[model samples]
Target: MIEVQHLTKRYGPFTAVDDVSFKVEPGEILGFLGPNGAGKTTTMRVLTGYMPPTGGKAIVAGFDVFEQPIEAKRRIGYLPETPPLYPDMTVRDYLTFVAKIKGVPRADRKARLDSVMERTRISDMATRHCGKLSKGYRQRVGLAQAILHNPDVLVLDEPTAGLDPKQIIQTRELIKELAGSHTIILSTHILPEVSQTCQRVVIINKGKVVAVDTPDNLTARIRGSETMYVQVDASGADAQGALSQVPGVRQIAVTETRGSVTGFEIDSEPGRDVRRELASAIVTRGWGLLELRPMRMSLEDVFLQLTTQDAAEPEVAHE
Candidate 1:
């Protein structure tokens, strides 16, 4: 588990991370997202013991990162934006060196190294010098090293960077598999990846925590109303008027039309369900109920809404 309390980082007159705070539960994959220059890297650096914060505190795996740097670092596996690879060493030798430094038992080093390299899809490149590897291979090598020791937490900054689409998929699956054993903080600019991979999200802006919640909760909080998409086949009959009569239906507009079938976007009062009423009305009128489903806001929409607004007190989600 990891906790950050009022963590702040400053450089002379500039504050890179300001009073930021959040937590990653044991075995949870938390997505760390922000626009460029939003202090994502700065915060990650402090969390990984790459640098000390100006104020506040960070704890990793039961050890205060600042107070017990050695113990905390021992439990954390970090893959920074750029893979730290030695130019002259082959991938096997490089990982072997890292294994020793990270305290991988000498007896199990070979098996661990082989498993990590294979899982990261870099087994074929084991004999290749790290510096000679293509960007993708280097990134894979970086990932292999991070998990070689199977630390308690993984702090990955763009772990999928430089990977091809297939490689990206593989990495995503691997990260998902690592959950329940490794508490992960995945910081990336890829929105879709966060939505698919992270259990919760922490969106940062201007060095401050802007939002913290599950993706679903953030979408619901930002949307402010319930929206539904409905399609009806009534041969151009005014289905909108019929739909408007349903209780809790606040607004309606046609979104598409194809012959006798028509699609409608409906807005309902918050916490209300109008599907039953809408469906009955359509059936009673003998109009074909083609399609009907809730239209939740996309993660991108939520991200844009939160980041574009003036920084507000972070909307934290609780069970």
Candidate 2:
């Protein structure tokens, strides 16, 4: 539903977004991730036709964003980091105004408004002034306005920012519900939010696309060694010796507790399953196997490794 090829945006001598390219398929939720000053918002603005790119082309829903901006924008719904809101207007009035500007038909505007308000759970605040609502409610109102026109593509920048935990969960669910019918590009700093809500992720650093893949695949790619945490009722030295007997185990470090139980982490060969073998070794050595489990890598680690790895390489100056 969205395609960008060699898109670059510059402000004088500084390149805010540098030769970035990617595709978002229909019904796919593509998570756009990066640290501050990574040009994420600039890219989003270019895609939404709010700003034109200095180089390359972007097409959304079959229309080139630069050559056919009106057509491209007609199919897109965009919500910036701080929602474009009118504080003086009530929720109902604001949404109605947006619907009119978005060219919603007079006959369908009311229905669209109702559907969006219900979907975003802002129906209760319909009559309340936008400025009077809490941050969470105001966010819901912003979401309601964005989708009120029912565009085929949704571009959301930090949609859940500033919301409480409960509100964040609710917003995540709402985004998931909208995924199948809408091609979405979600930009957020919350790694877990992307891991939970998006089918694929694109990691950008310093204005360039560094990594793009499914979350599980990206995690697997960066994982160098498998880890196993084991606890046994024995001396640390004895536990380490027992673990060494397991095939595929590369390294082990054990520490003793007050009750004669030993805690150890065993580094295994990549892609190896050492839990079963470790358990058997503990049993054979006459030590009680208190716990044995494979360690899982967190999304944060994967994100940092990929972004930092790219940044460490020296940049080749582009004319």
Candidate 3:
């Protein structure tokens, strides 16, 4: 488990993280998402005990990061944006060194090293020098080292960086698999990664917490009124006009047109269901209903709305 209470980090006059607070439950994968320069890395650094916060406190697995740095760090496995690799050492040798420093039992170090390398799909590169490995391989090696000790918490800052599409998917799956055994705080600017991999998301902006909630909940909250996408074959008739007359229909606009089939986006009053009336209206006009479905906001849309605009933090379940 990880808890951050009003954590703030400042460098001289500049505040990199401001009054940020959140909690990651045991075995939960929390996505720390934000745009570039949003202080994501700075916050992760403080949480991992790599740097002290200027104000407030951070607790990792029951130990205050600042008060008990060693204890807190022992439970935390960190993979920074850039993989820290020694070029002169082979992957196996480098990970062996890290295992000793991280306190992996000497008797189990070899087994742990082999297992981690296999899990990260880097077994073939074990003999390759860290510096000579490709960018992707180096990233994988960094990941192997991070989990070599099987720490209770993982603080990954862009773990998938420099990885190709296939590698990214592999890394994503590996992170997902590690969730039940490790409390993970994944920091990245990639919107899809949060939506697909994390159970909850903390969207940060300008060094402040803008929103914290599940991806689905955030999408629903962002759309005040329910929206529906309807594709109709109107036989050259005006489908939008007919749909607009339906009860509870607030607004309707043509989103696309192709021959007789026309697509329309319809907005209805909050808590209202206009699909039935809209369908009836279209049917009465002898138009063919090709498609009808509720339109939910994508995570990207929610991210843009919450970060690009001035957003107030909504009440969220911290624990």
User: Quick one: best TM-score, which candidate?
Assistant: 3
Give the alpha-carbon lDDT of every model.
Answer: 0.91, 0.88, 0.90
Record all residue pairs in model 1 with backbone atoms less than 3 Å apart, i.e. clashing: none
Identify the leading candidate in terms of lDDT: 1
Kindly report the root-mean-square deviation of model 2 from the true structure over all alpha carbons: 3.6
After TM-score superposition, what is the CA distance of residue 255 in candidate 1 from its true location, in Å?
Answer: 3.5
Q: Please identify model 1 stretches exceeding 4 Å from their true place.
A: 105-107, 232-239, 257-262, 280-289
Evaluate residue 229 in candidate 1 and report its C-alpha lDDT on the 0 to 100 scale: 97
What tens-digit string does per-residue lDDT give for candidate 1 at 159-207?
9988999989989999999988999999998999998999999999889
* lDDT preference between candidates 1 and 3, better one: 1
In model 1, the worst 10-residue window by lDDT is: 310-319
Writing each residue's lDDT as its tens digit, candidate 2 over 24-45 gives: 9999999999998889999999
Query: In candidate 3, what are the lDDT values of residues 242-295, reduced to their tens digit?
Result: 788899999888888898889999999999988889888988888899999998
RMSD of each: 2.8, 3.6, 1.9
Off by over 4 Å in 3: 235-237, 311-318
